[model samples]
Target: KPNEIVVVPGKVLGIGKLDHPVTVIALDFSSSALRKIKEAGGQVMSFNKALETFKDFKGKSVRLMKQ
Candidate 1:
């Protein structure tokens, strides 16, 4: 979806490219992945921060991407 926040339970690796801007919340991320995400005009956050940002996150559209 467009303008959606992606939550990853594990680490994010730098292996591919992002076409559009997005907000990514993950446990951890590789340095390259962080750089790439920023370059793509995306925001990266931690799991805790995500939870804090979205207080009522019980039933939200959160997609998980695997490596």
Candidate 2:
């Protein structure tokens, strides 16, 4: 979705393409990946930033990956 937030528990690499614009929170990301994401009009940030931004996770459109 356009404004949804997705949390990834690992690093994001530049091996694929993103077709939609969404917010991605990950531990780390490669330079290429960052460029691609930004090119697609998506937002990227670290987990720490996410936590700081959204202290209350409830009632928000956030997606968490299963372990």
Candidate 3:
């Protein structure tokens, strides 16, 4: 879905493409991943920033990725 918030426990790499925009929160992100995300109109943020920014979101709009 577009404008969704996703949290990655580890680093995010650019291995694929995004068809919709999203807010990616991760411990780290590859340069290519950052570029690709932005190119797709998505937003990226560090875990700490996400904590402060989305403190009120809880489980309503945040997704935790595992794999």
Per-residue CA lDDT of model 2 for 1-67, tens digit only, reads: 7778888899888788788788889988899989988888898999889889889888879888643
Which rank order by TM-score, best down to worst?
3, 1, 2
How high is the CA lDDT of each candidate model?
0.84, 0.85, 0.89
TM-scores of the candidates in the order shown: 0.82, 0.81, 0.88
**RMSD of each candidate relative to the true structure:** 2.0, 1.8, 1.4
Which regions of candidate 1 deviate over 4 angstroms?
58-61
Please give, for residues 1-67, the per-residue lDDT of candidate 3 as tens digits. Answer: 7888988999999999898889999999999999999999999999889878877785657789995
Best by TM-score: 3
> Is 2 or 3 the stronger prediction by lDDT?
3
Task: In angstroms, give how far residue 9 of model 3 lies from its true place.
Answer: 0.1
